[model samples]
Target: MNYNTTEAFAQELDQKDPLKEFRNEFLFPKNQDGKPQLYLCGNSLGLQPQQTANYIQKELQDWANYGVNGHTEAEHAWMPYHEFLSESMAKIVGAKPHEVIVMNTLTVNLHLMMVSFYEPKGKRNKIIIEADAFPSDKYAVESQLKFHNIDPAEGLLLWKPRPGEYTCRTEDLEQLLETHKDEVALVMIGSTNYYTGQAFNLKAITKLGHKHGAKVGFDLAHGAGNIQPDLHNTNADFAVWCTYKYLNSGPGSLGGCFVHERHANSPKLKRFVGWWGHDKSTRFNMRKDFKPMPGAEGWQLSNPPILSMAAIRASLDVFERAGFDNLRQKSKQLTGYLAYLVEELNNPNIRIITPSHPDERGCQLSFQIKGANKSVFDALSKANVVADWREPDVIRIAPTPLYNSYTDVYTFIQRLKQVLA
Candidate 1:
């Protein structure tokens, strides 16, 4: 496909967009003059779908009418509310319905998954992770290490990139696994790195980890609903993610977890148990012995939050309607257009840190604005371009194909050029 730096071309693309109607389905942030700002922040907090209120209102109504009986009598039936969302949620992450569950927040779910999978024995106590893993993940792994009385400085192995490169290479990971073949107990990676937006080959990572005799898991916080991590196909021991980001659920929405079917029925597997995870047949009887439910639902510890799930349902309804294939196709074109525009500037200082290969990244393209500071980010924000700024000279922009337009990409680049000038 031929590409050009023309506003008319951008508009033409928008006109031809099959998913154009989705733009109106979301409420965009407005500038002071009340126009929709060029929103590219979906990688952080996705825009609210207009139908979210209706979903919430229905639950609110059920609570008002049913009171204490709402658990069994609500329109969504609170007793099994989370189950209603399982099929669609599982589909989003590319896992079987039995393998995925909507539950606690991301970090909390990570800890839960680790409780069962991170079995350290003798010399195999060390954990391997990507160097630039999200801080929360690092903290969780470090805490897990400390919990087991292992010193993080000694027990945590970082799979770093080649000097000065922003993304980690899989060959480096393989080399690291080979070097520490006997020492590793777990290999926990952020499938799509939060900082660099690098999407790893999940199946490859899992295969490598298994070959080295280690449990492999992924923090799919960035990969879920962005790139298809294919959790089941990867045969990852476990995976976790938050819904608030690319899933377009409300702010700080509940997270999701996946445990491969192989471990789903392991009664011997240890976990932090709760009544919700007990056998539903005798849950209310409250017996002394904890009869664990089967599959991913076995990891859950509490009743579902219908309010949050309602919001998730609303966003997922739109996702189900639009379909990920269409969204991804639009996403590549959108991000590619932004990458092209950035290159058009011809400024040696403005270099894209994201991989040029389509499969290596999702929607985000991190720009290393050499010598420029956060002030450039501030100016961009003030110009109504909502992007993210990381410390030490990087401006992160994402063109979410769901609600963002080709025109948004063109206008953003024009504004960025003005800011650069």
Candidate 2:
């Protein structure tokens, strides 16, 4: 599709967008001159919902009006606050409500899930992760290995892209599993790699891991809202994602978790649990024996942070109103438009590393600017284009369907063209 570099063309698309009204729902960033900046960095931190301030303010008022009683008397009721988010979040990830829970931060949830799913047994103690997994994930896995008194160098394996490629091939992953079938115990991959913007084949990975007698899990920090992941159909043992990115939840918001139903009722499964994971009926009794709640809620460690959950509530409400299917459809169109524009740049220096096939990605596009460095990013920032720079030479741009418009992508490409020239 050839996009016209004209305001009229962009305006026409905006007029036809079913989600055009959503752009007003967010508080867009502005330059020092007070002009709204073209924000294409939703892959990093999503724009704040217009209702977020009101949501946070409501919590403050509850604290003032009810104090300790706010747990039960608050407007939204803090006692079961996390439950309010579960249904919407479950919808976002394509999971049953009982199989999902919103709690803790991203790394914290990953570590917690590993406690139950990464259990290393007698000859099957090794774990496999993508070579370029997000730094936080790598650190969490390394620490978990050390916590278990295992040597990371010997027990952790990294699946890498081929010599000149930026994405991992399923064939390579299968080969590794076959070679290490006797030693591999678990496989944890980033559902969509942070830097490459490559969305992995979850169902295929899960099936192969299971065939090798290994459990499969995913860190979906870049995948959750950017792409629709059918966690239940994938049959993954577990998965975790942060809400701040594509979910549009505020900074440091609570992360989400999914535990496959097969393991939901595993009475023999060992986990590091707390009272929050115990049956609510007897939890207040403060008994010694812990009877875990079935499903994803069984993994909770403590009461969630209500203030953060409030921000999440505000965001998920936006998602619920807009509908995931609607957002996803627009996402494909918005991102496809961005890709179309970048390719038309016709700059031999610029090369998109993200897969060309739409099925292999979501909204993010990672590209390398030939012979350019961080100064290239500095130039874009000076022009009020808000894309992010990954180290070396890559810049990642994501046009979120909920808040971004066709004009934003059009203007961003114009600025990028100037910067490159």
Candidate 3:
């Protein structure tokens, strides 16, 4: 596909975009002059959907009208409010509905998954993760190691790139697994790296981990709604993600969890028990012993916040209308245009650290500014180009397909060129 640098070309592309109408469905942050800022930070936090307030209001109204009876009397009964999100959430991640559960936040779900999957015994105690994985994941894995009395210095293996490289290589991961051999008990990785924007091949990673007899999982915080991970086909034991990013749920919304159908009824697995996770028929039977729900729901520690789930439902409805495959197609082109324009800049000061191949990335493009300069990012912010800055010198831009336009990508480059000038 030919990409032109002209603003008119962007407008033409936007005019033809099937998903262009979605841009109006989101509420963009306004600058002082009352113009919508160029919001390319969906990789960090997505713009709120316009319908979110209404969704929350319905729940609030139900609570007001029914009070405690809202448990079953509400239109979207509070008792099963979380279930309303499962089918849509499952569709976004390519998992069976039963395999997906909308539950605790990302790190909490990560910890819960580790409890069941990260069974380190004897010498098979080491855990493998990317050296540049999200900090929360690193902390969770380290604490889990310490919980089992293993020092992180010896028990955690980092799959890092060769000297001076930005992304971790799958071959390097395989080599690390081979070197660690039976010493590794778990392989947990972010599906798409947050800082670098490099998306890992989940199935390949899962197979590699299983080959070494290690339980494999993924943190999909950066993948859900941005890329279809096909969690079931990946054959991973588990995966988790937050809804606030590409999913377009409001800030700090509930996260999602996926447990493979294979583990759906594995009674041998140990999990933290909760009333919500008990069998629905017997959940209210106060005297009955805990009987876990058959699938991913069994991991629920408690009922989720309805307000958060409402926001998620609002966003998922939009995804359902837009269709995931269509969004993926648009994302590849939207992000590709950003990459093309950045290359056209031919600026010595800025270089794309993210993988050039669309298959290897999502909507995000991470730019490495020379000499770790922070001033360039400051200028971008002052110009109202709402991108995010990472430490050392990377500025992350994500042109989300759901609401971001090609013109937004074009305008951002124009602003960035001026900043560099």
- Which numbered prediction scores highest in TM-score against the true structure? 3
Q: Model 2, residue 62: what's the lDDT? A: 99
Model 1: ten consecutive residues of lowest lDDT: 285-294
Off-target runs (Cα >4 Å) in candidate 2 are 1-5
Which candidate order results from sorting by TM-score in descending order?
3, 1, 2
lDDT of 2 by residue, 1-421 (tens): 5576677888799999999999999998899999988899999999999999999899999999999999999989998888898899999998999999999888998988898888888879999999999999999999988988999998899999999988999999999999997889889999999998999999999999999999899999999988888999999999999999998888888899999999988987779898899988888998659988888998998998888998999999999999998998988888888898888888898899999877799999998978867787899999998999988789999999999999888888888888878
| Model 1: lDDT to the true structure | 0.91
lDDT of 3 at 315: 96
The 10 consecutive residues of candidate 2 with the worst lDDT sum are: 1-10
RMSD from true fold, candidate 2? 1.2
Instruction: Go through the candidates in order and give each one's C-alpha lDDT.
Output: 0.91, 0.91, 0.94
lDDT of 1 by residue, 243-331 (tens): 99889898889999999999988977889999999888888997658888889999989988889999999998999999988988888
- Say which prediction, candidate 1 or candidate 3, comes out ahead on lDDT: 3
Model 3 clash pairs? none
Q: Cα deviation of 177 in candidate 1 (Å)?
A: 0.6
By lDDT, the best candidate is 3
